[model samples]
Every structure is written in C-alpha cells, then in structure tokens.
Target chain A: MRAACHAPIRGDFTGLRGLEWDKMLHCPAQAARAIPTISAATSMSQTRHVFFISDGTGITAETLGHSLLAQFPDTRFRNHRLPFIDSTDKARDCVQRIKDAAIESGIRPIVFNTLVDPSAVAALREADALFLDLFEKFIEPLENELGQRSTHAAGRFHGIADSQDYKKRIEAINFTLAHDDGVSHADLAEADVILVGVSRSGKTPTSLYLAMQFGIKAANYPLIPEDFERNRLPVELTRYRGKLFGLTIGPDRLSQIRQERRPNSRYASLENCLHEIESAQRMMKREGIKWLDSTAKSIEEISTIILQEVRLDPQSY
Target chain B: MRAACHAPIRGDFTGLRGLEWDKMLHCPAQAARAIPTISAATSMSQTRHVFFISDGTGITAETLGHSLLAQFPDTRFRNHRLPFIDSTDKARDCVQRIKDAAIESGIRPIVFNTLVDPSAVAALREADALFLDLFEKFIEPLENELGQRSTHAAGRFHGIADSQDYKKRIEAINFTLAHDDGVSHADLAEADVILVGVSRSGKTPTSLYLAMQFGIKAANYPLIPEDFERNRLPVELTRYRGKLFGLTIGPDRLSQIRQERRPNSRYASLENCLHEIESAQRMMKREGIKWLDSTAKSIEEISTIILQEVRLDPQSY
Candidate 1:
C-alpha cells in the first residue's frame, strides 16, 4: 500500500500532527499479509491506497513516508505538493474523495491537507477517516522546542549592496582568520562580523553558515567570566563596534545545554547558567551591542535575523 | 507585483497558478488576500497574501515563513498550508483550485515548495506560476558547490567517535592553541562540537547552526599552511582527534571567497588555493580521516549530512 502523510501547514513536515512515523507500522504492505495487519481483514491484493495530507507542505509527508516505508520499507513515495489552500470548498471535496478512495481501495489511508480550510478539517474529521492536523500538533511544538544556541561566528557582512558581492567577505574572513589563527585579538579590525555570546549562544553555526552559505566572514568569541570581570565587550570589540553583534539565550536553556556537556560542573549548574545569561544580556545592552534573543529560534532563523540586522554589505570578493 | 524568479528552471508566469497556505501563513483568511499582493497592480489594501507550504506539517516551513515575514521589515505575511496530497493527481487538483481562487482574489503570489516533486513541479510550471524548488534550486546545488570535505579527527574514530565525550575534545583542541585574556586552552575541552575547515569552507555558519538549533557547544578552527605543509592535522587536534571535523572548499570557490576578502592576498591566489586543497585532501586521506565535501553544498545540507553521518540524529531535537 502506498500510504502517505503530508504537511500543508508547515514545510518539512514539522507541523504534521499525529501518527509519529517512528511508531507507525514499518511494513504496512507486508503487515497486511500478516494476520494482524491493520487491513488484514480485507482480501484485496490490489488494495494499494496512497493518502497525502499535510498541515503545511509535503516535507513531513515525505519524512513520514520514509518512516512508514521503514515499517514497510518496500513502499515508494511519489512526490506531491499543494500550495497553501485558503478555502473550505476544495478541502471538503478533498475529504470526500479521500474517504471514498480509502473504502474503495480498502487501504483506509489518511490524507493530510496542510492548509485545508478549518471547514475542510471539519469535513475530514466528520468523514470518519483518521486525519492528522499538521499545524496544532507538529509545527507549533517544534518551534517551541528550545535548544542551546552555538557561538560560532560568521564573517562580517560582505558584498557591495549594488553588486551582491559576498565573495570578498568570505575570503577576507578566511584570510584574516588564517593569518591570525592564534591572534584572535589582532584581526578584530578586519572582521565584517564578530559574534559575542554568553557561553554558547550559537555563534559558530551562524558564522559558518554565513561563510559557507552566504560567503560572509564571521568571527565569534564567548563572553567569559573574565570579560564580565573586566566589564566589557572584549576590549578589542571597542575598536569595531559596528561589526559586533551579541547573541543571548534564556538562562534555563543555557543551563540545560551546559549540563549536557559538563553534567554537573559549577558552570553547568542551572543557577550558574542563569547568572551568566543575565549578566551577558545586561552587558550587551549596556555596551550598545546589537543582539538577538536566540532561545526560541532555529539556526536558520537566527542567521537571517543577524544578517538582516547587521546590514553589512561587503564588496570585493 | 510579487516577482520571484527561480534560477534553475526558468520562471514564466504567463498567468496565476495556485497557492498553498503553509505554516507561516497561519491565517487562511489572511493568505487568501496575501497571494495577490505580489501581483496586485494598483489595488492596495491591508490584506496580506503570504503563504507557507510543507509536505506534512508546518515544522520547517514555519521557520522559513517567519523569516520571510521578518525580511519584509514593514510588510506582513498571512500564512496558510494546503493539506494532504502525495501524488501528481492531487497536486494538479489542488493547484487548479488555487489558481481559480487566486484569480478571484486578485493575488498572484509565488509558491515555495520544500519537498521536491517532479510531477508537481511540472504541474506548477504548467500553471504559469512562480515556484521555489527548495531542493532543486536551493539544496542540491550546495553539494556540488562545497567542492571540499571535512575530516574526522578528535572525538572517536580518531576523535569523532570517542567515548571521551564532546566537551573534552573541544577543550583539548582549544587549550592546545594559545588564546589571550586567560582563556585557557584547558577550557577548550569543554566545546560540545568542534569544526575545522580550510579557509572559506564555511565553518562559522555550520557551527552556529548546530549551536543555535541544537544548543550544541561548538568551536571552529582554520586549516592553515604550516599544518598543510607538514601534511598533518593541527597539533591541537591530536589531543581530541575524535571530536574534530574538517571542512574544505573548491579552489575556484576558495579564490572567489578569498578575493572578496584581501582581494590580492597570496593565500587567496587561485594557484595557492588549489595547492592548499590538494594538500588538505591528501593529508585527510593519509590520516584515514573521514570528511564531507563542502563545495557546492549549502550549510543546511552539509549540516544535515554531517549530523547524520556523525550519528547525531536531528530528529531527536
């Protein structure tokens, strides 16, 4: 059976609701042959039903398909997508077709409409077929899953605003970094972007993403206790204020991340993590360092926000 | 008009195609109005026709949606998702309904599909609409573009797979390298993850991606001439070989990345860059280190592959 799941609400199946593929039957087709398969009662050899529905896009559908196939590894996922829908009529029509197809095919597969009209959702629920809500279930929860952020930094923004020249920024950051490998403080003046974060606020990933993806040079430094002891944004940052940006995460999140590494170090202690976050944020505000609250955001989101915020357009590469 | 151009497959919007309310386009009612703003001529109103599309759930799509909305600075995105469709038939049907509705609404907006589906792609193209093929245009290119790969050094297999844990590996490498302000190399062992890359291979952003998204402690280091000259990984890496990973880029890409920085540095010279890459690759092979080619691959793809290769399942988060 070509059973499928989709997310119309959120791209990448992040918002897909219910039916954790992990827990789904791995070999639905094979399972059917087994005495206890979900559809074993039906004696239809041609009982192949493909159901596609999403809260958003088909990403989760694809992912879910993979898991379902894992249960039934022999299944093939035929790609499909429906741009966000805005009306209930289409959704209603879709539900009716799905319900009918399920009965006819004897597969009883579920369909996901990522952005079906709420009325459409009502229609599906009323159809007596299992329907997964990609929005309320999956997407929302993933977004709220707070993870520790990194401190990797990208090169300062490069690219001539007119030319979109990011190449130079990447090279400069690379050269500056290479030439001054052990000289972190020496090249502060050459940086297009420098990251400052309390412990690990996701500086490194953003920096690497910028360089690798956008061809921007990015540098990052942790806000160690010593920096706070001195009560400054790294004395070197004073020389290049425009290029500096700060990243901060919620104290609770920070502590959890630390605990993962050190387990029980004083620094990894929740209280310590909270103290560090509070201190770093205050320092950033006082130092007039433009910063981002990265606690709730994904790396991609954080990178975009920082890049847009810095507005550092470099040219020359 | 909402003008979006896909680089790979030429975009010819002869007319409106369809809209899928995705995760970002949370309000279907709002998305109904938003899709047309891009195509709206003089008819201006408060309605936003922004939409987000995903296969299963709004998970990843929601992130992109939020970022896009944030990009407009002043503009708003009314996001929605089209639910459930996994085959060409459903895609076509959904697209047809969307095209009809878009015309009535006067919003001819671009559709972004994260999941790559040739059939749906063909249908979307046939509809004379703007489509964003995330994998085709955005993702696959990263793999070919990376041109270089990273090496597994410090944690376990070498250092990447060791039972010593992540932080210690990072700190060991860091401690080996000298830093000012009492930032002891001894503390380098604390890094949850470490990224090593040739200049311009995009270490910064990848590090940040992990840190920000996964809250993994990360550190990044550059692969320099002396290390290459000796055909060995950095000395600091010896202590934590399992935790170490390398990133490399193509010579041409390196040149482009470098020229942007120093414009004329000998290191950025194509000849030098090529030599550096060859040496790095040879050394990695000799060291029996595992690595990923960074050329042509975007940070997201690279991160995905490496995280998976490293057995760090992103799904856990």
Candidate 2:
C-alpha cells in the first residue's frame, strides 16, 4: 500500500465538494506508487481553510484578512475568495462552500466577511465556521457616533459612487501611462508629481501605484549616465522643480534588480549601479528636490511617502 | 461683515499646527473681500477629522476606514494619513497631529490605526480622540483561534518578507506592462490570463490591477472593428482558449469611456460600441470562453471573477 499524501489538493471547491475525505487526501495510486518519496514531503505545519466573503470585490476583507493571518506565521491557510455575494442565493451558496471546506479540511474554517445586507449576513452566519463579520461589528457604533443611520448599502464601498472622482482616477491612470519613463513631455505641467530616479530604482511601479490607488497623476523620468555627465537636471524636469521627487536604491539591491533584467551586462554591474545612484542623489540634493530610498520599501510605502512629502493639492488634480 | 468660510483648510499639518482656529477657518482677508459670495457656498454638512495611522503603509487602515466612513454620507471627513509610525516618537507626533485636527475642527477626531508595536500603540492612544486600533481587536481572537502567539511584528504586512513573492509581483507588473493592449506578442505563452475586450471596455486597468494586486501576469487585447468584421477571435489568442477571459461593457458606458479618449468621433459612437461588444461576446460564446460584464463592476470584481473561472494552477505560474 502506498503511504498517504498529506498536501491538500488546491483548486476550485465545486469539483471537490462531494469527494470523500480519503479520496481527497490521497494521490492517484499509480502516481503515489511511482513517487514513493511523496509521503516524506508532507508539511508539518497546521493547515486551516480560510475564506474571504464580501458583497463587493472582497478585496478589503482579503487585504485585512491577509494582514491578520500574516501574524500567525506558523500555520498554512488554504485561502478562498467568494466575491460579489450580493443575493441571498449567493450567500447560501457561500455558506455551503464554507461548510464543504470545513468538512474537507476536518477543521472549522475561518471566514472574514464584509456583507452589508442584513439578510445575506444572517444567511452566511449559519455556516459551521468562525464567521468574522467585519461590517457588523462596527456599523452600529458608527451610526450612533455619526448621529445618523447608515445606508447599509451592499456594494457602495467599491462602487463608482462619485462619477467625477471615477473620471479623475481614469484620467490619472492614462496620464501616468502616457508619462511613464519620460515617454512624453507634452503635458508635464499636468502631472501631480514627477518621480526621477536611476532605471529600476522603482519609479515605474511606484508611479502606477500612485495613479491606480490614489488618483494622482504621477510621471517618472530615468536619470541616465548622460544626466550624471552633465551634472544637471533634465531640461524637461527643471521647469517643474516643485513636482520633482527622486528615488534612490542601494547599489547592491539595484544591481540585483537589474541582474534579473539583463544578466551578465555592464548595466547590472554593482559599480555602475553605485555610480548612477550616487550621481542621482547628488543631483537631487543640489536641485533641492525631495527624495527617498526605495531599497526595502514596498510600492505602497514609497507612494505614501511621496504623497506626504509632495503634498499635492487634491483639488488641482 | 464676511461670513465665516466653512471649508476646512487642506494642506500639510506642519503649517497649520500653530495657527489660531479662527485664522485656519477663515479665508485670507484680501481673498474673502474679493470673493464675497464665498459665504453663500458654505457647506451645511457636519465636519469631522479622520486619521489612519499604521506602522507600515497604512493602506489597510485607510481602506477599511474608508469603507466604514462611507456609511455616513452626511458628514464631511477631513482625512489624514500617518503611515510608517514604527517608533514612539512618530506615534507622539501622530497624536499631536490628531489633537491639532480635533482643536481645529472643534470635534474629537476619529482615528483608525494598525500599529503593532506596543510602545507606539500606547503612545498613540494618548490622543484625545476615538482611537480604533484595528490590530488590537482582531489579533487576540485570531491568536486564540490559531492556538499560537502572533509574532507582534511591525511592517510585516507590506514589507518584502518573502523576496521570491515580491520578485514574482514585480515580474508580473513588468509582464503586464509589456503585454498591455497587445503591445507585445513575445511572451504570449507566459501570460496567466488573457483579457479580450473592445477598446475602453476596461481591459488595461483590469490587467494592471490583476498584476499589481494579485501578482498575476495578465495580457489584454482589444477586439477592434477589424476583428468584428472578420467575426473571429484574434489568431494569436486562438491557441490559448483556456487562458482567455472576455470583458463586455454596456454600449452607453463603452461609448462614454471612448468619448473621453476621442471626443465626437465614430470610435466613440454608441453604434460602434454596440457592434464591437456584440461581436466580441458572440465569438467568446462560440469559443466557450468565460467573460464578465464590466459596465458597473470595478476592476477588482472583474479580476476576482477571472481568477475564479480560469482557476490557473498557482505552481505553474
């Protein structure tokens, strides 16, 4: 007899709902027999099925859920996202799925939900799992504090509530895209903030994040060797001194990032990265442009800092 | 006498900190005299100050806080974000800022925080505000449920904890960028999902969202008028039927989106939008490819559906 395989089968729950626990746990007999070492590869960590259910996109529940779960690094969570659970029928389906996950894992599943509809919330609460209703816990307190009744809207949080705001965000994304890596100088004046950095110091992704998340038109320009030789800011950027923000990276990290893009090239050399970053920093200092080190920072962190430092007028963009 | 200006002064706290409340509330004398009608534009809505504080990016705090605050549509919130508050000194500064806002608004501020460090949390709790520490409420319950102590780590949620995962996300962003709007066919085989849609049907933003948030390499191709005329799926996408996901929008919404790009043109006409969407949907139906209506759905909703329907193997990507 082949040894039992402990790794959970990862896929959609629809096909696995009716399967027996033994069948779900075991690999195919032929494959298990062929790979006798499979049983030895079993993970020692505890496994728990986790679900993020919401009336809208479920992004909030998932984001907060992930943050909470990150604290418990010892356990492995088999994650599932059930988004757009607007109707009672969908809520019922979600409950059933949660129950199935509990049965399959032989552990009560942990669910984080942001359903606002009372009926839908009540329906999902019937599942035999640790249901953490995110909205239910705070809505009443908020209502009392605000001295008004909440709309209790299902999809309002992520919905396009304000058409003007939505349009501005879309425009920002387009502006960011058009100005990416100094591709176009036609509308440098329109940029809410312009990022200048050595290539791969993390300007592109940061710019995109600023636009996508905050509706800020961010443009980025690369500080190449020619700029360093000239020891001056780009002519296109000189006029927009107030909008300019610089990004610098550690030489080692810059080289490591570039190494993946262009292996065994002069551009990926540590010496080159060092010289470029130093030159960029010196120029930024001389020009009185604010800058940040993006060595270990996430794009969100970098964007947040830029927003704080740049202090762009929200109404202007 | 000039009626008091009601709009909250929006700018950096450093400049506003020591200013008298009257000076902060009222517009400049010259401007107020010139624009005498400003008093007529005073908003009657209740105003409150809101703050999101965290040891990391504070994005999770802001996201959840926004969701909660959206319930109260009647109140205007003067929002502030104090991110990367990992030290007691920073937390003290944050508390001071909150107090300043409270004084300026003549109402206690509402603070949402996700600080993990005990010293920082304690320091921030000193503010004369309704402090809602997000982590404090959830961490204990989670700890009890998991039967393990949390690591109590600051900045772990958004930091580069797993370098491999971070690298994959960066690669995904690059891949999505290169493959955006069918700009490159060099790595079509590597895309985790290919989105097919008519122009301005929300393919690019959705693709970028999938890449940025979920670390999925998503490529998008617009089903142009030529594709509708040919009445067929694009030849390049035919081989990857399983990876294809289509996005269809209401003709009116599509036309409006296109109008923003090219105003008063045939491309932005409702008739053209309808024909392109119908043909694309028909082709997708014939090919048995899954798709969604992007008319009112946010990019997060669309991407979640695609991830669910496509069910790509995590290991394969």
Candidate 3:
C-alpha cells in the first residue's frame, strides 16, 4: 500500500485574478481555502511543479505528504525529492526539474518543505513551486499538544503474563535511568528499569524499541570504567537491583552500527567498541545481572527478549 | 532488518529461551529438531488458565496489535493477542472477557478465520480457555522481531513515484476482472476513486479512504440506484467498477452517513439496520465486494485512510 508522494498542496495562486484572492484579505484561513479554487480557475493552475524536499533524510516531508493527502483525497500527485544536498542551488534545481516535468506533462506540483535547510527554504520561496513550509509551523503546536512526554510506546502484553510484562517494565525503568532525555533522576530507586551496556552496545535503538514495542518504559545508561572499577552497579542501581537489564553486542557488529552513525569518532572504532562490549559483558556477569548479546539479533529481538526476560511491561496506552 | 526472517532456518535455541531451560535442550529449533524432545517438552509444559479471544471485526493478529503502533509512533505498548480459539470450555470464558476488553478498547483488534465463530471453535475442543487459542504462538515471533518492523513504518512510502503508486497507476483500468485475493473489476476502474457512502456518508470510509491512501490501484463502486430503483449506483457499476468503499453507522448515525453514502437508502431508516445496512449495504453492493460503514468508521478509517494515502516511500530498511 505504500506509494510515492506526488500531490500538490494547491497553495499559491498563479492565476491572474484581481477578485479571486479578495477573500484572502478577509481571513487567512479563508484565503488558504480559496487558493485551490482560484488556481483551478486558471491555466497557470496546471503549470505548477511540486516536490517533497528535506534537509534530514526527507522523513518529515513524507509525513507532511500523508497529512496533505488526508486533506485532499482526490488530488493526483507527482512527487520528487532532492536528496542529501541542502543548497539553494539544489533547491532551485529541484524547482526547475519539477517545472520541466509539469511543462511536459501538464500537471502542477507542490513543494513540501519538511525541515529543508534554512537557506534552502529561501530558495524554495524564490522557486515557482507552491511551497508549504511545515517545520516552522509545526513545532510549538506539537510541543504544546503532546506536553512533557514520558514514553512513545504502544503495547499491552496480552498473551504474555502481567509479571512477565512487569519485569520488562522495571528493566525499561532502569534503561531510562541510564539514558538522558533532558530529565533528572537522583536515584536508582526512582528508576522503573535501568539499562546497563558499554558505550555503543545498541543501547539507543534497543531502549527505544523496548519503550515503543513493549512499552517497557526503557532508559539506557552506558557503562563506563569508573562504575566497573568500583565493581558495582551504578550507586543508584543498587537500590533498584531487580529493575536492571543489560544489553551486550558482539565486538564486530557493535563497531559497525556506531561507525555509521559517527564515523571515525574515537567511540565508534571497532577496538574501542569491542573493549566496551567485553567490559560491559564482564561487568554484568560479575554483578550477576542477566544480559543478552545483540550482535546477530535484530533490535526487535534484542529489545523484546530484554522486555520478556526483565519482565517490565508498562501498561499505559 | 527483514533479513532475520530469512536466517537460513537454523535449528538451535533462539533468544526466546529463558535462563531456566535445561542446557541440553536450550535451543528451541534444535531441541524441537528431534521429535522426542518435542514430545517431552510438550508433556512437561503444562497448560495455562487464560484465553483471549476475538471474533474479528477483520484483521490478522500480527498486523493488528503490532501494526497498530505505526499510527501513533510516540505511544509505547506491551501487547499480546491470542490466536484462533481452540476447542476448549475454559478457553471460552477467557476469550469472552478479553473480547469484552477489546470491544471497550476501541482499536481495530486483529482477527483470523472470518468465517469461524469463537464459541464454536471452543466447542470443537474441550479445554479450559479455548476461546483465545490461535494467537498464543505468534507473540514470541512478533516480539522476536519488533524493531525490524517498528520504525513507525520508517520507510513505508519513501522514494515512490506518483505514477507508480496504486491510485494513479491503476486509475483507468478497473475492469471487472477477477483477481486473486478477492478484489473485483468495476471495483477497480470505477474505484479510480470509489466512495462507499452510507447515510450521513459515514465519510464513505471503507471505499473512499482506501482510494485516497495506498492508491491501491483503487476503484470505488458506489451503492447507487439498483437499491434505489432497486436503487444503487447503476447495475453496470456493480458488474464493473474498481474499488468498492463502504460507509455504515449507528441507527441514528445511519441517516448521517447514508446521506453521504448516497444521501438516500430506504434502508437507512432507524430500527431498520437489517434492511438498510445488512440488506442494502450487505448482500454484496455487488457480488464479491468489500465494504465498511460509518458505524464501523473507526475500523474502516483504519483500513480506508491508511489505504487511501499510501506514501510510496522506497523501502527504508
């Protein structure tokens, strides 16, 4: 059912009409509504070009496309994207490419800016595309609507026992404890589940996966030498011994995922990553906390196993 | 991420095995590799008390709970759903309660065996909680592969071209041709955009939304005049069309969606659900057509809107 996004927003009016846009000065919302009609009234309507552009992998533009289609169900789409490059030149190039296509095909296109580069945004403005700048308008409303978020997970351990889910729930609490999300936590007792892993041990995806797929409410904290040197779980973790779960990965694969995210960074090197994975494994063993090696396993497998093994299942929707 | 499923099917223990299993039988595939081990393990693992059943409104177990997470990415979850109800008495009660909970929860609970009855399935077997049975096994598999499917549908419609997307691609050729998987023809072409409106239009979710979403190669065949003369859209439409979208509603709501479904169904009268919805809406808007009502909008909304605007993003993983 997945399809490319190609629908135009029908935003600007390329039509030459003195009275067509008189409705806009009356109310911006109404003006926005009239845009589609005015454009439909003119030959220029079919001359526009549309594209879904982004500065960050274009994920946001894809989302905006979904939302726009929801608004205009009948409109046909002609989608295009300029990947990785975030220059005004790229943006203008995108506009021209789409324009060329529209001229040939007789269909206008809309440019959806989902986090396009700041400068590129200006380029879109100069282009003849009907651009709908989403990032600028979405942030505050999204923030206010969602409020302070705890976790963005959705699972209810149905066939799985409550106890099994709860185990994962506690482990997630600990994982969350170890990770930082601009939140403050003074002690392990305050944690629901704590995650212990050496640096780059697939912690973030595993933790997020746990919180999301299983609603384990996970937080991950990287294990470093100081804690191992002391031969102890973090001081905070001692108070919530039952709530901790550990994630480990094979030395080689651990290095790969990290390297991709941050190439050549000291932390992402195979040697460094392997050192941490090994040390974290030893630390978990010494501490008697059960852990799993995530090297070969998919993140889903790793997180779900942790969720089940640790038995932490947060029930909130 | 999707590769794990094709992991050469090695027969050994999987990550699912908890710490307590005997080392010799640790590997699930390997342990089960031999028939004796399977028999022994089967005998040893006693049955449990609960059964969670669902007389499906229509969805597969895996796709329902797990896939539901895609809609709200931020909501974390710990979900489990039992499979087909096995033949057992104790299972029925368990199934009933869970079914009740599901009804209350208001999400599109996944289902299997559209033709089977939960109670009847229980009767087929004599067990404690047979009502909820078919689903028990899949939970592990799903958990075992969470993140692989869970990037919030990360790249569902990435990089797809508009012309290639189903709606635009399949627009003109919706001939009443029989195809596998129960889709029909007029249902196809007439469905280039088909809105199955029930009174008050039910927002014509089932049919219209699907067109909007995936471009499922859509074809919407309205329930017009044959039901009206017999009055439905023309009989030829039934014989040949693209997608058939359906919109239904509560008795009172029927008037509303029906007004939109066509704004006219003699069957839309209050207290006449059987005649209006079941009869006109059912009895095959045309033979072998799928539908949804405004009353069933939430579910249809899930099916329709999702199917309506599929962003043909290139596969992310």
Candidate that would win on DockQ: 2
Off by over 4 Å in 3: A1-183, A313-317, B1-317
Write model 3 residue lDDT over A114-167, tens digit each, in one string.
442467666667655455554443333333433433222211111222444534
| lDDT (CA) per prediction | 0.46, 0.74, 0.40
Query: Which residue pairs overlap in candidate 2's backbone?
Result: none
lDDT of 1 by residue, A1-317 (tens): 32322111221121222222222112122211111222332344433344444333233333333322222223322222322223455455455545554664555544433442455456556564444443433333222321212111111111122223333433543533342322367656666688888776767645654554345667777788887787777776677777777788878878876887688899888788887887887787676666667665544445544543454322111
TM-score of 2: 0.86
Number of the predicted model whose lDDT against the real structure is largest? 2
Candidate number achieving the greatest TM-score relative to the actual structure: 2
Candidates sorted by lDDT, best first: 2, 1, 3
Considering the true interface contacts (CA pairs under 8 Å between chains A and B), give the fraction that model 3 also has.
Answer: 0.00
Give lDDT: candidate 1, residue B7. 8
Segments of candidate 1 deviating more than 4 angstroms: A1-317, B1-297, B300-317
lDDT of 3 by residue, B56-88 (tens): 211122322222223234543324433222234
- Candidate 1 has an lDDT of 0.46
The RMSD (Cα, Å) of candidate 2 is 8.7
What is the DockQ score of candidate 3, to 2 decimals?
A: 0.02
